[model samples]
Target: MRIDCPHCGLRSNEEFTIKGEVPKARPDAEAGQDAYVDYVYIDKNTRGRNVEHWHHSGGCRAWLVVERNTITHEIYSVIDVQEAQ
Candidate 1:
């Protein structure tokens, strides 16, 4: 698979580091047990559209935010992390 890094253009998947799903929330150390566990260990693993973080380590070394389909692997959008946040 190829991921198009905005800074580096089209490149093989090997050029980027997949940083898993985008975090929706983080629990405080003092939060409830279940909440903390859910935040740290659980993955809702949504079946459709999902956002991911990717780093172009082999190319421009820029962080990218990617909107992709979980089941189809179709990338709908790619943006720099700077712009995403």
Candidate 2:
């Protein structure tokens, strides 16, 4: 697998570290323990297209947003996390 880091050009997947799926929103601090527990421990693990956080640890060391097919491992797009916002 390969990832096209916007700042470092194309690189091997080994250069990156998977940081898991991006959360829709973070739970509020006052939302209580159950809410926090669910947010921290639960895994949605949905199949199909998913957006994830990847760190270019072996390259530019930048955080990226990777949009890819979970089942096929087909990367649709890779962009710097800041640019993604």
Candidate 3:
């Protein structure tokens, strides 16, 4: 698979690091221990399209948010972490 890093242009997936899915919002302090445990330990393991955190470690070394398919591995878009915010 290839990822088109905004700063580094097209590159192999080996150049990047996959950090799993972007997490849901953190539970408030009062939300309880179970909520926090689920947030930290559980993997949603979404099967279709999802947003993920990727680091262009071998290239520009920038953090990026990648929108892609989990099953098909089709990358729809890549954006810098700063720009994603």
Highest lDDT: give the candidate number: 3
**C-alpha-based local distance difference test score of model 1:** 0.87
The TM-score leader among the candidates is 3
Instruction: Give the candidates in order of TM-score, highest first.
Output: 3, 2, 1
Q: Pairing residues by index, what is the TM-score of model 2?
A: 0.87
Q: Can you tell me which runs of candidate 2 are displaced by over 4 Å? A: none
Model 1 per-residue lDDT tens digits across residues 1-85:
7888888788898999988788768887788899987887787788999998888989899989998888988999999999987
Clashing pairs in 2: none
lDDT of each: 0.87, 0.90, 0.94
Model 2, span 1-85: residue lDDT tens: 8899999998999999999988767788799998988888887887999999999999889999999999998999999999988
Where does model 1 exceed 4 Å of error?
28-30
- Sort all candidates by lDDT, best to worst: 3, 2, 1
